[model samples]
Target chain A: MIAIDFLGAIGRLFLGFLQAIGTLSVFTANAVSHCVRPPFYFRSIGQQMLVIGYFSLPVVGLTAVFTGMVLALQIYEGSSRFNAESAVATIVVIGITRELGPVLAGLMVAGRVGAAMAAEIGTMRVTEQIDALTTLATNPFKYLVAPRLIAGTLMLPVLVLVADIIGVFGGYIIGTSKLGFNPATYLRNTADFLEAIDVITGLVKAAAFGFIVALMGCYHGYSSKGGAQGVGAATTNAVVSASILILAADYLITELFFSK
Target chain B: MAVDTRIPKVSLRDVHVAFGPKKVLQGFDLDVMPGESVVVIGGSGTGKSVMLKCLLGLVTPDRGSVKIDGQEVVGISDREREPILQKFGMLFQYAALFDSLSVWENVAFGLTQAKGMTREEAKPIALKKLAQVGLGADVAELSPAELSGGMKKRVGLARAIAIEPEIILFDEPTTGLDPIMGDVINDLIVACVKDLGATAISITHDMASARKIADRVAMLYQGKAIWQGPAATIDKSGNAYVDQFIHGRAEGPIQVEVRA
Candidate 1:
């Protein structure tokens, strides 16, 4: 009986996995169709940019600064054991630009903007505001989805660029002043080791991460069921799904950009 | 032969809508002639709102057709839908005001966003509409969150008429208001629809509102319109379902679903 129960559990898990994948595919299809439609809502895009990007700056900036400072200290300590303390500048620049900037930005946005989008839109769905928009001859997608998608895609790269600069600057301050490194040599090493591809790859990752975050937010929100409880679930699901997608996509993009 | 020659501003024929296995609307038929105010009344979950949504093209009927000004709406392209939509204004149950914008901004959203009117051009028109619904210019600068329930409904009414739409839909417009406020909203709805010479379709369980605002009243039950008649004749609709609803009797033809 225990064996039979275990087998049943396994079968249920498998079905659940398939159901999740199927739902995600349906969401992706709906988002694509909504994105391509007309009666584009430029105002929604601007509002989302204000909400998701501009308001998010202080937190993203602070996180990047601290992350850079810590990375420099850790790299300095680790390299000194191998008698290669001079590699601190290279590690800080490359690490911040290639991986940390985009990933952190994605995760932060998933927490801040993604959750907010899901909650707002999900509440609207539950309360029938989306239905109201439709009845008014307003395409909820063109009015709601397109703007968030466009704003998320466009603003993320700009945010990531700022994060990368702040992150590098944090490392420079810690490395030169605290670690007793020569400022000129640290600056020169940082410039020499980081290539255009590294920065460009991070920006590309930022854009992809932005798309995933916004799409998941809008999809879960638009399709949210029940009332308050359902909207809460959608918010949680949006953040989790967006965070996972961002990490997975970051890996693929990194491989594409750097792998021989 | 004598002809039924009145031109309907909106009409639906054999409309059927389903969500998966649950049929929300089934072979629903309705006609509202130009400048007529029609109220659809039913208990919760009886498809009154769904019928209204179908006519608005918000929920596409799976079978049959909806026509606005004699133009079939079900399968028309977006370009074909826009002009039809421009003829519509809707006041939702919860007001559905944009929380980010001030009251006037919400009222003028369609005007500024869809009609290409500058904020300066739209503000006075929005204020004028607000005044028509008895809101002062001081309320225009306040966000939706700050407004009382009655105020929000008035703002929604203002927004609905801002563009002078030829048709208006009111979904449970008096659901949460006090009796006095509800009467005020109903009177405002009647005045606006009359002033605009607009055909109106409203769904509500508020019989007081229905009596105050409707030229004709229809009762929906079990996914179909069970009875329809001129407002003066609703008391003698003769159908058991309609009698049960208007009289608020629990022991009549309408069965309340009590979960055991």
Candidate 2:
């Protein structure tokens, strides 16, 4: 009897997971369709872009710069042991543009923006504001989810682009100031080693990560039950899921693009 | 032959809904006439909100039919439901005002977004509605966060009525307010619905609110309307559940689940 109960629990868990995936998939399809449909809420979309993109600049910038500096220091220390200290500049540029910059920005924004969406929408859900939207003839997807999704997807790439520049510059600052390298050659090496595909791939990953962050946040919040505790849980779930999905998506995109 | 012209504005038949094994509604049925104010009363966890949500298409029933204005709405696509949805306005419990937007913006949201009215055009109407709800122009620029509970409820009411909907829904409209404030909101709801000649359905455990705003009272229990009658006769309702609820008695035919 105990064995049967254990098996049943396992079966229930599997079914629950599948159900979550199915619901999220449908939500994504609905949100995407709303994003493309006419009668767009331009002002709402613009406001969300400002919140998700413009406000995120400072955090994303700080993260990218610090990461770039640290990457430069680490590569210099490792390569110096093999008499290949010159590789530091090349490594720093590649690391920032191709990986660190986008991933760090994605994760930072996920923590900041994803949690906000979840909390805001979750509060709305518990407060019955979302249902109010429905009765007001406003589609929650169009008024709420679509704006955030578009803002997140469109804004993250721009953020990552700026982060890429700042990150490389961070590496340059550290190389010249701390690590005693020829400034002109370090800059040239940085430019020479960087490829367009590397930047493009990172940006594509950033966009996907942005979408994931918004999607997870909106899904959790919209479906949130009860009051304060439920909103809190949704906020935490949004950040965790967005971070995990970002890392996973980053790896997949990398494998698709760079792996032979 | 004379026509039977009095069709219900909203109708639900044998509706069933469940979350997992917890069935919230089983064969629930209700009919609401146009220009009628029907208040549904029940204890907590009695599926009152679920029934309201089902009527609004926010939650779909596992089985049964929902008809709005004599048109079948159950299982209809979102695009098809837009016109139907446009006929509604709702007042949420706790106000549910959007914290992100200023007071006027929240009130004007549906008008500008769903009706495609420019901000300039919608501003006067929003201001007018706010005044009607006993709020002044000074409060229009304030965020919802800055408002008192009563003020927030007023703003929420203004927003609800601004769209001039043919139907209005009120969800626990008196839940978080003092008795005086609750009475004020109840009065405003009655006035607004009467002014619009809209069909209204409200769900609340507040007897005072129900007595004040309801033209008729429906008692929901075990996923169905166990008793329904005119509000004037509530003091002598005679139904056990209704009596227990109105008197706040602990012992009745309605079971309150408690774990030992």
Top-DockQ candidate index:
2
Deviation (Å) of B217 in candidate 2: 2.3
Q: Which portions of model 2 miss their true places by more than 4 Å?
A: B1-5, B258-260
Model 2, CA-based lDDT: 0.91
**What's each prediction's clash count?**
0, 0
Across A101-192, the per-residue lDDT of candidate 1 in tens digits comes to 99999999999999999999998898777875765556777788888988899899999999999999999999988999999999999999
Expressed as tens digits, the lDDT of each residue in B1-260 for candidate 2 is 68547999999999999998999999988889999999999889989888888878889999999999999999999889989888888887788888778999999988987798989999999999999999999999999999998999889889989989898989899888999999999999999999999999999999999999999999988888898999999989889889999999989887787999
Q: Per-prediction DockQ, in order? A: 0.45, 0.75
DockQ, candidate 1, vs. native dimer: 0.45
Docking class of 1: acceptable
Give per-residue CA lDDT, model 2, range A1-260, as digits (tens): 99999999999999999999999899999999999997687888899899889999999999988888998999999998999999898899889878998899999999999999999999999977787778878888988999999999999999999999999888889999999999999998988988899899989998998899999999999989998999999999999999999999999999999998
In model 2, what is chain B's TM-score?
0.97
How far is B24's C-alpha from truth in model 2 (Å)? 2.6
TM-score of chain B of each: 0.97, 0.97
